[model samples]
Structures are given as structure tokens and as C-alpha cells.
Target: MSEAKGHPPVFAIHLTSSATDGTRVLAVGAEGPLSADLTDEVAELCRTADDPGRAGAVQVLPRPLRTPARVVVVGVGAADPAGWRAAGAAAVRAARSDEKLQVVVPPQTSPEAVRALAEGAWLAGYRYRDAPDGPRSAEVDLITDDAGHAPALDRARALAQAVWWARDLTNAPASIKNPPWFADQVVAEAATRPGLTVTVRGPDELAAEGFGGILAVGGGSATPPRLVELSWRPDGATRHVVLVGKGVTFDTGGISIKPRESMKLMRKDMGGAAAVLGATFAAADLGLPVRITTLAPLAENAVSGSAFRPGDVITHYDGTTSESTNSDAEGRLVLADALGYAVARLDPDVVVDVATLTGANAVALGKGMAALYSHDDDLAAALTAAGDAAGERMWRLPLPEDYLEYLHSDIADRHSSPARGAASVVAALYLREFLGDRVDRWAHLDMSAPSWADASDGDLTKGATGWGVRTLVAWLGALGR
Candidate 1:
């Protein structure tokens, strides 16, 4: 037990043999035998726990040895980076109090595994409630024999904090996170930051600037719509990247309306915007050398007399007209406007758009990964590699040229909703039209599946997953300093 009741826990990393003798928490993987330092009694108690070697399994008992007060053994089934993260996260959650915690770094743990363990613990520590709770308990320390891994752990902490920021934004209630409010947060971020500039355009400006997609979808809500642009350029940066996010704060399927059950989680429709915000902030904080521009078209898809209806025609920012065939297909409309604005205004070396755009994406890729569509193979490969490195999985789905016809509408340039078959790819194709031929290296991440997790696991809680933030940050970091 911790000596103090409310004091934040202290985290330290130590070699298994060097763990301090005191009342403490010892986190270890179940794959191996107990450390030789542990007394025979503690080892016997651990072996008594059935199937302790299974992933996510846990066994906690009073320390029979002269060391810590309690020993918590967590199962890192495969002893991989992901397994280590899950083990660390589960151990932190299972621990009863904020006490001095020491995690024994597995002898075979790679630097990446060390980072994962740190990130897992860091993320599990976050709790979002409206009440003014006091600060969280002490920090977690990683005990390792090698001192060289400290810098990597520091970097991981920063990245995990960025993810936490995104999760907070995404988890915010839609009533409090409307378009104007979301824009306000960007303005506030820019006000405090040094290298970032934020520009927000309201409904009047959006209409004047020909952002009909945003205006049309936002017309039903009293909150209006906004196009938020954030630009960050560090000194001596050569490469440029533009990121666009669909910020539908809440979606009710407009006039089409959604089933009651389907509408419950619509507040997370702004997950893409949250991700880009987090990634941009992370890049700025880390002092990455690549110039980055983030665009979020913020709106609410509500139902009212003014709501855009089926068969309505909308001219997007790039002068491409679209027919609103299904009001539920609103994400692509807002994203199309931002994507066009990025290509037309920024002229970056590459463009990427993230959106919780389609239910079909959940069906195509399941909940484990996002559906990735790219215009250029090199950019696609680079993003895939980045996602792999960041532990966010992406599956490349082709933007079949043949699917373009599904978007054709007799009254307008195209239809917002295409045929239901291959729906996710069709949505991506619709966005590609707005990019035009001028942009070569472009990619779309349909993040519906990965944007929110159904239950808490590993580094994620049961709300917004903040999935793309890490992947985007990793991609930018890999672009070189």
C-alpha cells in the first residue's frame, strides 16, 4: 500500500534485480518464471493462478518476499510490442491505488516495446469527466537496465499526450462542441502557440467563398458552419503536407434521418477533425521540420426546414457540383470542400484527408483497421509504413476508376451517395474528384472503424480511439527534420 492516500503515484523503471524493497507495485509479464529476487512463496502464489500466460490475464498477490507490498504479474502472451502495451495498460487499471509503481522491463523488450509500455500506462491514466476532480495519481516509471531508452520513452509520452488531447475533443458532447465552439478551440490553440496560425471562416464567409457543401449541411443547425485552417511552418522546412478533416460535430442524417440506435454515436463524427488537430499540435510541439497545413470543415447535420434535402444540388469549393442523394452521406460533402480548399490554396507536396465517412468501411476493414485509398502508390506506401510503425493498422483499398460512374447524377455533376456496393471506395472516389488532376500525391483514410473503440483495451478506453493522430504524426516525423 502507498504511504499516502491521495498522493500521485511515482513510476520508475528498474532492472528486475534492482527493484527497491518497499511497499510498491511490480508489473511483470507472465511469460517467464518469477524473478530470482522474488522469494519462493511469491513464486508459488503466481503459479497457482490458472493460465496466467494468456494474453491480458492477470495475477496479483501480497508480496511474500522482502520487496514490494504487492506483485502484479500481467500476461504479455506473445511478448510483442502490442502485447507489452496491453499488459502495461491492464496492470495499471487493475492496480488499486496510486502508489509507487515499478514496471520490470522484459529482458527481451525492444526499444519500441519499452515505448509501448510507457504509452499504454500513460494513456490508461486519462479520465474525462465534467466534475473538477483533483490531479491524477503519480507518474509511472519504467525500470530498465539500459539507460539509452529514456529519450524514446520521453517521445512516447509526448505522442500519448497528443492522443489523449484528441480523445478528449472527440469525447466531448456535441452540444458543447458545435462548429463555432470547435473553431473557438482552434483560435485558442493558435493564441497560445508560437508557430501556428489559425483562420476560421463562418457561414457568411463560407457562402461567399463557395463552400456550399459546408453551408448546406450546416444550414439546419443554429450553430452555423466554419472552415478552420491551421498552418505551421518551422524554420528551414522544405517539404509540405496538407491534412484535411471532416468535422461533422453531430450527425442526425439530416432530413433522411437515422435509426435511433444508429444516431447515438453521431457525436464522434468529428473524430477526423480531432485527429488532425492533435497531429498538428504534436508536430509543432516536437519541432518537426515539415511545413503542415490542417483544414477542418466544421458543421452539424441536424434536421430542420433549412436542412439540405435529397435531390438538392450543391456547388463545392472547387466549383464541382454535387447532388445530395442521401443526406446520410454528409461526411464526404464537407470533406470534399476542405480537400478542394487544401489543393487549391496550399499546393502542398502531398494531401491527406481523414474522415469517419462510411459504415461500409467498418464492414470492409472491421474494427481493427482503417480503409486507406490513395492516388499515388508512393504516398500510400509511406502512410502504410507510418501506420505500421505507430501501431495503427491501415488496409489499402483501391479507388477503382470504374466506380466513378456511381457518383454521376443527371441534374448535377455528381451524386453525394453512390451505389451501396463498395460504398467506402465510392465515397473515396467522390473526394478524389475534388482534388482534381493538379494533386498527384493524395490519400483518404476512411477512419470509421478505428476512430472509436467499443470497449477499453490496451492504450484505448471505450470512447474515441484517437487512432489517426499517431499515424499522422509518425508520417510527418518520417518526412525528416
Candidate 2:
């Protein structure tokens, strides 16, 4: 419940052969470990406790034991990367009050498992607060005799840092996070990385460039809108991937209006942009051999006399016309301009856009998964595999050609938010119209459901989840390789 003024510290991780003089964490398998490399008293206590060893289950010893006074036992069901990740997260949460921890790495664990463990622990330890009483900083030591796992740990640390940065950006209050402010934050962050370059377009530039969709959606707010173009062009990079993110800093549904309850979490409407920025930063930090271009369209959809209304026909960046059927569907409108620009200017091998575009995504997939739509099977499969590896699961939805008729508008080339049912699909179809002939290279992620968590889960806190970051980072890493 406490707040902190600045970013929280990332967990300090080290590789060691034995437990440090602090909290010692032991892992238990689903069937119970046949032999645990632990003190006799600790092992006996674990047995007497009757722990089931299910993934994410944690148990803390009641009494202090030896050099490492505190002891915590976590469950790693099936002993896979997912299980190890869950176990690592559970152990860290159980001993969150402790400043130091020694986590026992299972014997002969693969580098993937080690990376998962480090990522889980680092991510679980993240807290966004503005007071001195917030979550305390902690350091973790992965107890293992092998030195080869160090590289994996390093990669995990970088990925975790990227996710944490996304969470911070998404969780920031809307009052202080307008479009220009968001652009400033991203520009400042990109300045620190040597390989990244950021160019921000303000209201004047947007209007001059004929980005009507972005201008229309942002007209209601006094602060105006911004389009941030972030690029990372590494030498000798072969593939160019363009990422577009919807950055509705706060959405009041803009004249269509959301319920008061729905507006409570509108601050996180920029979650997609946060994820894009995070992935781009991660690529630079990890020195990935891929040319990456990120387009973030930022605006605040607030209610005012100047707000664009339903039935208004607006021209987009590529001269395409769209009739707004519902102002609440503003995310897709802004994204249309960015996608149009990406297709027109950036000649990339792949284009992926992430957005919290529809509430129907939550209705269909619930809060733990995102809805993925793509015409390209290879890209879909690649993203699905990356999500599986990164713990950010996504379900690919069918983009039926028959649904294209639903977007038919009498006044314009397309209708934004044309149909009521299959809302997520309709939104995806609307955005697809902007991709031009590059439709096969485009993929859309409606991450509304998973972008913000209502409850704390493994590697996810209750607020902004930073959902797409890990998946995007994983996919980019694979592409670079």
C-alpha cells in the first residue's frame, strides 16, 4: 500500500556454490525429492510439514536453522523451466522481507531452467511504490557449482529489467502521464542507450503529416498527442522488424463515455506502448543483431466539446477514410495511423502491433491470455512458441474473411467498431485495413485481458502486468539468432 518516488532496484543475482549467511531456499519436486542437499534438521522439518510440492507453493520454516537462519522451501512441479520459474517466484515472495537469499539450483539443471529461475525471482521482486515503506531491495544468490549458467543468468536479468520498466510506465498515474510526458519519458530513456535513436512528433507535426486518425482521437484532450518513432539499427543486421503500439494514456471513452468503474484503471491504457518500448530497450541492451523500428502513437481520449464523435469520417495517414461508430474504440483509430505509416515508410520484414483494443478480448480469453490475430501462419507460430517459452501465453484467433463485410461503412472506406459481437475480431479486421499490401507480414495482439492483472500471480503483480514484453523480447531474440 506504500508508494515510492523512483524506480525500484532490480534484484542483484550471483552464482555461488553454497548458501550465503541469509535465507536459504530449497526446491521440492512434485513427488517429493528423493534426497535434498540440506541440513538434517531442515530436511526433516520439510518432510514433517507435508508439503505437496505443487508449482508456486511455498513454505517457510518456523525456527531459524544454522548459518542461513531463515529457510524456505518452494515447489517446482515437473522440474521444467515453467516449474522452476514458478518456484523461483514463490520463493522470492515468501522471503520478500529478507534482504538476501540463497536459492539452491537443482543439480545438472539446464541453462534454460536457470534463466527461467532468475527471471521469475527478479520479476517477482519488482514493486512500484512512492514511499520509503515500499518493498525492500533484495539480492539473490543462485547456489550452483557450475559456472556455465552465468550467461543465462545475465540474459534473464536483462529481460527482467525490461519487463520491470514496462510495468513502471504502465502503472504511472494518468494525471502526470499525458501524451507529451509519455513521449518525453521514452525519449529520455532511449538517450541512455547508445544504439537507440528516438524521434518524437508533436501535435503540429502530426497535423502537418496528415495523421488524421491520431489527431482525431487526441483532439478531445488539452495536452494533444504524439507519435514516437524509436529505431535500433545494429550493424550487419539482416532482418528488420517494425513494432507498433497503441498509447492511449487514459481513456474516458471520449464522449461515448465508459462507466465510472471502467475509468478507474484507464491509466493503464498505455500498456501496449509500454511493452513496445520495453522490448525495443531490451533489444538494445542485449545487443541483439536485428534492426528494430518501434512506432508508439500516444494520446488521451478524454471527453470534451472538441472530441470526435460517432459518425464522424476521418482520414488516416495513408489517405484511407474510416467512419467512427464508437468513440470508445479509439485505440484502434490511433493504431490505424501508426500501422498506415509503418506500411508506407518502414520497409520491414515483419510488422507486429500490440494494443489493449477491446474488452471482448477479456470476455473470450479471460485475464491470463492475450488474443493473437495474424494472416501469416509462420509468424503466428513463431509468436506462439515465443509466448510459450516466455510464460506470456496467447491464443491465436481466426480472422475469417467473411467478417470483412462487418466493417463496411457507407460514408468511408471502413467502419471503426462496426459490429457488437466478435468485438475483438472486428477491431482486428479494422486495423488490418491499414496494412495495405503488407497484410501477410502483419500480426495484431489484443492484450486487453492480460495487460493489467486483478490479482497477484507468478511473476505478475496486481497492477499493470507488462504482458507482451517478454513474448516480444523472446521472439526478437530468436529472430536475431
Candidate 3:
């Protein structure tokens, strides 16, 4: 395997009036006039092409008479923000290996639409390669004269870069992404920013501080475990929000080994950690006026003699003893410890934890949507709106009081896994037990299904999709406003 950690290619975006020397991309609506540069011949070609001017449709024409050697016409059906985004992505993808592109923005497009277009273009251009000498992204020029769209374009670039950083971390091979290495990468990235202070606690510190859940889950791995705290404390910030993420670098189900097919994408088990890290980085970059603290409990649940077995009762950081009915259900174990620590020591006004916690989430919400569990109606609404705005949709699931008995343990205070079904709900209920009295201020995101994609779609690649970063960043931005 290649030692290089795959980083997404960067696209240099420019706002210009004239088309560049490379490929020219035109956005055409189903019922609108063609771009001025397009001749009568091209208009006739579009009229005859099947599904021309439909959303996400792409039609490439080799224009011998045009200044640019080739022209790509992308459909912008109804010209909405979503349509514009899809058009942008389809345009860049049609450009293929071209290193430079001039994309024509539709007339009278709003600044929000312009931002969406740029985001979709930049995100679709992302390609993660294991080799250092992999192909780079195209230099894109948004052919428009609207100077008011500058700030929106800049914001789009920042958000895209944050998502790219998250995807890079999540896509890194398990061979080089153990707990220590993960901590090192996060620390190195944080060193570049001034206000973001990072502290990493190793096995000794974790044991001494009573981080039992984290240590127990990581006991089987030779690389050990780490609890990483990243803080951004801005002056005059009234609300303090703490974000905890499960950072299982790779999971083999420990003593309860998983089937071979289920373990192939275990390298992406740390996607939640990547999402929180990306949101924090975006917050710092945007200089949001909100105090944010992020906790990532890192571990690898491998199979070994030292592995914590099923039926073992382990004490979590808050001194709550939990029976491990299934060693494979380890994400919630680490998240519980981190959430408990955050509530006890951080004095947070709000707490949100994201984790790839349960396969049952997929069963309930399919692979495209995430499972959201929160008792606070206000918090649930804010997150749902944020997710909708960011294009990472989430459906709030109930934490029923009736199902609390499913987690009952005869030998311990509570159990990690339930003997009955409703595994996703049970996992969230188990995590809620560690939140102390802050249950109303806490929200949990089970992003197990949406974290990785089976194939490349609109803004998602085949590997890590960096699901929760956008939603968290949007919500934080709203809070800052």
C-alpha cells in the first residue's frame, strides 16, 4: 500500500468575464436562450439531444470553430440552487481530464445559487489518490461579472476545503491510521491555526483519569488509544458547545469478530471523528464567534487475547458500569466516555456527539439519511434545518421511555447492546445514560450508513463522504449569527 495519505485535489476558482483557453462549460435551462458564444448549430444540437436541459444532464460538443476546442453544456432544470449545483458538478465531470475550465454562470442567478454552483463544482472535482503524483483538479473560472458573488464564492471554497480535509482523514488506510497517528495528524493540522489548542491523552493518562470505556475498547490493539481534546475559546462567547466523536480508527469486532464482507470498509470507522475535526477547522477558519470544544476518543478494536470480551462489565468515565453484551458495539462505548467527560469537566451549554455506531441505523433510515436522536425539540429542529441546508439530510428518531428496559443489565448498571431489536434506538438510549442531567442539551447522530458511499454520486465519492461536517458547520454558523 502507498504511504501517502490521499488528499483531495484543489481547484483554483476565478470569477471572470471572458472564457479561458481550456474547455468552456455552459449552463443551459430547458426553456432559456443559449449562451451568447453558442452558435445556431449548437442550439440545434441541444434541441435534438435526448433529455437536453434536464437536471444533472451533460452534453459535450467538440466545437471546431469555437476558440476553446471543446464545449460542455450542462442542464439546470428550473435553475434552482439545487439544480445549479447539479449543473456545476455535471459540467466539471464532463470536462474530464482537462486541467482548466471556464464555466458560464446563468443570468440573474442569486448569490446563494452562485455559491451552491461553486461548491458542487469544487466537491465533484475531488479525487483521492494513494500516489503522491496523482492528477490534480482543474483550474476553474466562473465566467460571470457579478462582483457581489465574491463572498459567497469564498465561503463555498472554505466549506469545500473542510469537507475535503475530513474525507482525506477518513479515507486514510488503517495500516497508518492508528490512534497515535490519528492524534498526530490532528495536532499537526491544528498547529497551523493560532487559537485552536490541542491536547492528546495517551493510555497512561486515560487509565489514571478513569477513561475505562476508551481503554477497554482499545485494549486489543497494539497501537493503544488516545483521547484528543481540541478547544476554541473565543472571548465574549456566551454559549459553550462541546462536540464528541467516536474515533475508532479501524474495527475488527474484537473478540466478536465480524464477517469478512462487513469488515472491508472498517477503515472509515473514524468518519465521525473526521466530521467533528472538520467542523472545528471550518469554525476557526471562518472565525465564528462561538466557543467550541471537540473531543475525539480514538481506538482500534482488534481481535487478540487481551481483547475485552462479551459479558464483561466495564466502568465508564462517569463511573457508570456497562455490560458489554457485544464487543462489536464499541463505537458507543468510546462515545459514552467522551460525552461523560465533556459534561463533567467542560461545563458545556450544549453537547452533540456523532458516531458510526450501529448497522441498525441503515435498516431504519436507508443509506442516504442519518439517524438523529435528541430529546430537545429545539435542538432537533436546528440540526434538521442545518442538515437540510447542507444537503446532508437527517431524520430525528425517538428515544422512547418505553424501550429503556431493553438495556437493563442484571449484573451491571446498564448494558452496551440489547438482547432485543431496535438496535439503533438502544444504542442512542445507552449513550443518553452517560449525559448526566444534560440530556435535554444533548443530541446524538448515528451516521453509520451515510458516512461511506458505495458509488460516486452528486457530491459524494465512492469512499468516505464526510457526511456530518457540513451539517455541524452550518449549525455552528447559525449559532454564531
Candidate 1 residue lDDT tens string, 296-393: 99999999999999999999999989998789899999998888888788888888999999999989789989999986888899899989877799
Query: For candidate 2, what is the lDDT?
Result: 0.84
Clashing residue pairs in candidate 3 are none
lDDT of each: 0.80, 0.84, 0.84
Alpha-carbon runs more than 4 Å astray in model 1? 1-57, 64-67, 75-80, 97-100, 105-111, 132-139, 143-150
| 371: Cα error in model 1, Å | 0.5
Sorted on lDDT, best first, the list reads: 3, 2, 1
Task: Please provide, for model 3 over 126-191, each residue's C-alpha lDDT reduced to its tens digit, 9 standing for 90 to 100.
Answer: 877566797534456786767889988988888888888888889999999999999998999899
**Best first by TM-score, ranked:** 3, 2, 1
User: Which of the two, 1 or 2, has more TM-score?
Assistant: 2
TM per candidate comes to 0.88, 0.90, 0.91
Q: Pick the candidate with the highest TM-score.
A: 3
